[model samples]
Target: MCYSSNGQFLTQIPTWLIVVAGWFVVHHLSQKRDQRKEARERVDQLVTAILSIEERAVRFHQSDSYQGDVARSLLFDIQRIIAKLKRHPFGSFVISPTLLKELRRAVTLKNFDASKFTRQEANSAILSNIADAVDDIEDQLEQEYERIYLSTEWFVVPSQQKNCR
Candidate 1:
């Protein structure tokens, strides 16, 4: 209860109650903002990893020395990344089963023995598959990123609309 000037009665909320309510609202908003930031960071890390794979694939494809060890190492790195992405909480949401299947298919170098195939065949086939897989992953990531970050829109409340009109 509150009394204004001239002892007029005024309905007043307790200051402590108002403060608590404000705190809750602020805390909720802060949590949501933090979640969004973390999600964006995860997306960025995934994108970086994919880009690194692409760069490495391109370099290996162009290099004249088509070492089996290097190819095996690259494949292992890609598989490891894919496994990590699959295990990641955010990654599981963003990466689909179909995409994972496609990645696995692309990463598998069929009959790829460095000694058996000429340099050109190895480069064009195996490296190209890796490149294609990376491209697909990047495209999917971009779509997910846009859906999460760019598609949200705020709408005006009814009272605010009335005021605007």
Candidate 2:
């Protein structure tokens, strides 16, 4: 214990203890901020991937001629999304395991034939699945904005939101 000139009693806490505690707090906050930044970046990557897949899917589905190239690219984007979902911070809010499985199966089965769908039904089904996945991700991110803790953060996504409907 120590007494100040004003006759006030000083705490026995050590200077090193205060410094260590401050360092811990700063380190913890810095880590948290870095995590949030990473999560935001992952979301951006996911949206880019989803839009790329949608574009390729639409192009192939609309094309009447063989589109092996487009099909391959689309499959690649789907696989990218599948991988992205594994690290996407919003996984807790979105049910992605089933989506991932279905996307993988779709890629496996159609990687060779997606560009030239023989049946209109197949195109519709594939398109529906892709659209649903997009919508679900968008919804989850939108909901993320409403989170009490994340309110102070910000992000930017492609302008696809206006055209999704």
Report the C-alpha lDDT of model 2 over 1-165, residue by residue, as the tens digit.
446554342343466688999899798677767866777776777777776666666566656665777767766777666665655465443444665666555434553464445533444766676567666666666565335125433332212222222
TM-score, predicted candidate 1 vs. hidden true structure: 0.65
TM-score, each model?
A: 0.65, 0.58
lDDT of 1 at 66: 64
The 10-residue segment with the lowest total lDDT in model 2? 156-165
Off by over 4 Å in 1: 1-10, 14-18, 89-92, 121-129, 148-165
Per-residue lDDT, model 1, residue 163, is 33
Per residue, candidate 1 scores C-alpha lDDT tens digits across 16-61 of 6789998997986676567567767887887787777667655655
For candidate 1, give the lDDT. 0.61
**Candidate 1 least-lDDT 10 residues:** 156-165
Q: Which candidate gets the maximum TM-score versus the true structure?
A: 1
